[model samples]
Target: MKRKNILLGAFALLLVLGFGSCQKSDLPLDGTVSKERIAALQSNLKKALHDTTQGWVMMVQGLNANVRTAMPVLLKFDTLTGDVTTRTLFSKDKQSSKFVLSASTGVPLLSFSTFSYISQTYTAANTAITDFFFKVLDVTADSITIQPFRKGNIYQSEGGAIMKLFRASSDKMKWALDLLNAPGNTGNIFTQTSLFGRDLEVRLKASFATDSIRSRTGFYSWGGSLNVVKSNTPITRTYPTLNPIVIEFYTTFPIPANAVPLDVNTVVGDGLIYWQPTTALTPADYFLNGPNATINFLKTDYLLIKSMTANSVEVYAVDASGNVCITGRIGD
Candidate 1:
């Protein structure tokens, strides 16, 4: 009789514990309805990504820079056959590899299932384009948006890495590349314009190293063309009575417009390139050309790219903390 009573007591305790485990909050648990809706959404996105018949253009935040520095890449996905083709702004090689679409963590996650250049973008010691295990945010007939899915990832807020993929045409990809490399587009000068479109004289913020912003009338210049040369005296300056100083800056190296020419000394030493006041900022020949140009600058936290215009583009420089240190608008 006692054994029976003890058994009944144990069963009652188990029931109470099970009931207490489900402490409800504001979450809706209509159960089947919610689960079905999620499943349907996942199914729709899967179909869109897998059916990349015409290829897709993906716009993601520059791995080492900000959204303003975003670029597009071409992608072709085939989960059924388990392979993907991808291209980036820096490399033209069409990397192919096995990929997977899964719900292993309760949400749709897409990742390269093998070792390939596509995965290298994320795993590479230099670039941080972590789209490997992309968490699907939204999907439509022609486009899908995604963000990196690092478990306990803390860098998302500091660096905006959200990406969007759209159905792409061949012409669009060509245009993106052309805009980045248009002749004289990057090396052109940028200055603040007044209300009447007059060039405003930029005054540099006073510093312990220098006094008076007028120390240099031309605050910015683009390098990188062997064709047109930097003047013997690129900048003519005016200084205050406390510190009257005259300085001339010039360069002969093939410094690209979208880059700062750095001598070997600079690269191995401080590795910081201040865009405004220097001669031959960084040597262009020292590095490879094309999309790699941007990657090289990213190593030092300096991003110079042609603006998205036929006659104009902007140059932006950032500090180690990912904040904009200086900006100039170059125009023809």
Candidate 2:
């Protein structure tokens, strides 16, 4: 009778221990989601949208057209297991986009686009263009505010005239710099002379337009003397002092209107030229201009030529010269 009792007691103890283990296993391991994490996720998403490179593509396909003009849209986060379950937001175009971000890397894995138009002007000149800026504004245990930088015109041009003036001066300086072969001397007489002459023309036009306006019968007209004294300033340009080893090449590529020419030394040290033939030649075909040379086609990171005609091939690369670096043809 005692043995039976002992066996029964041991069995009951085992069963109780197993039940307790199972209950503990079923409980949440990391506990409930915290408010701080939600806030971080929101801020990170905003920053990513704002920090994209120029020419980045945004896909908009399915939202109402008027929604594209709205300011900032709020971010909604769903949290599970201390990670963001999903992020939903609308853009200025009132079209909704969804992002799935990993909590660990903060990198978005998948992005969806809704029909919307981007209202902010991204192609504006002479100003930093930021489409979006987001940061975690505030966080609570259950909610967060993803602060968005939206619809800002902080550096907007004062007027069209001002914008024109800015562009003109910028162009004049750029031309002068290019003429000098991007020399380092800031006080070159030729550059200064050219700049002065250009500036004078710009100023004269501005002044004439400003002073000549007259209102006759509620209509504006120019009433000042049409004849004006012309300045006899001599036009001259001096070449920039160049380093001995710097090589310069003239090409048809248009320089950015606002770009300041770099000194020759700065370009040569970091520059390499890629030379690709205009014609498509197979591995067995010898390069017409280059002796005993054929192209070794590489499919790796090398640039791909789309079509090869008798005279030219269409090619592109990450850099300007990537197409020029190939030396071998396809077979040999």
Candidate 3:
């Protein structure tokens, strides 16, 4: 009788294990729920977009590489008409594009199907950011959490980028345009910025005084241009693209072999630079190979003007986990 009881208990355990394995295989992508729950979520997201009369202030924290420190982009969505309007600091007026909420992949996706250059400033098929589809992670009455939606309508295995849209004040657009070209601004790129466990007093190289004055650095090599450059002398480099916007710094610091080097000239200068691009010729992230070894490298991989204001400039760095490691900002 004892042996029969033991045999029956073993069979029951096997059945339980088999059922649990089957349940795992049946789970859907994107961690989505059943068909009915998905429908409910879709309806809720629509309401979230439509109920906010004042619109949203949107900002993207890039996917461990791109860093956008500009003022958040303003977005107003007309859910009834499917029109999404945008207001940029650089624009005098707002622009509109079509948007859709799709759920064919067992997950909700907010897709921006149209293209606008002015809009592309923040959302280009971008190195650090994109103005394309966003996989909706969570949504509420006043905020929506999102990630850039790569193709396949699936959750990306590559860690996702997080963006948030908060309620905007009615007069937020007042901070637009004309403010971008405000006067009485000295052209200094960065003051003292420390990131990746290093300090970069990003002042114009006093030793390279003759090479000083103004430097035109391109944040991107394509249609996008970073226009904060004006040198006392004309740039003599002969490159096809206006990329690797160079910022030279010379201290008794040495370059790290594994550190990311920024050299628009293709020759890494003594001062830490952030412009040596990969084959795509685009600035690559991952400034360090192992621990913040840049203490010795003295190289900086980024020095673009804050995309938000020309009155002040900032040079900052972000870590892989989307933390602001450190920041240095300057006005004038």
Best by TM-score: 3
What are the per-residue Cα lDDT tens digits for candidate 3 across 76-115?
A: 7888899988753323245678888887555587887675
Give the Cα RMSD of candidate 1.
14.8
Candidate 2: C-alpha lDDT: 0.23
Per-residue CA lDDT of model 1 for 1-332, tens digit only, reads: 99999999999999999999987787666666546666876898778877656667765343433223344567788867877876543333456777787664455777777865445445422334554687776788667876667622465442225666776644435454343233442331222212113222322221222332221121232345322222211111100011101112113223345543322211100111211122332334322121233233332222344343443334554332224444554333
TM-scores, one per candidate? 0.44, 0.22, 0.46
Model 3 whole-model lDDT (C-alpha atoms): 0.43
For candidate 3, the clash count comes to 15
lDDT per residue for candidate 2 within 93-203, as digits (tens), equals 112333343332222222222211221222111112122232333333322233223323467532111010011123322332232132332221212222221111000
> Candidate 1, residue 175: CA error in Å?
3.6
Once fitted onto the true fold, the runs of candidate 2 whose alpha carbons sit more than 4 angstroms away are 25-42, 51-332
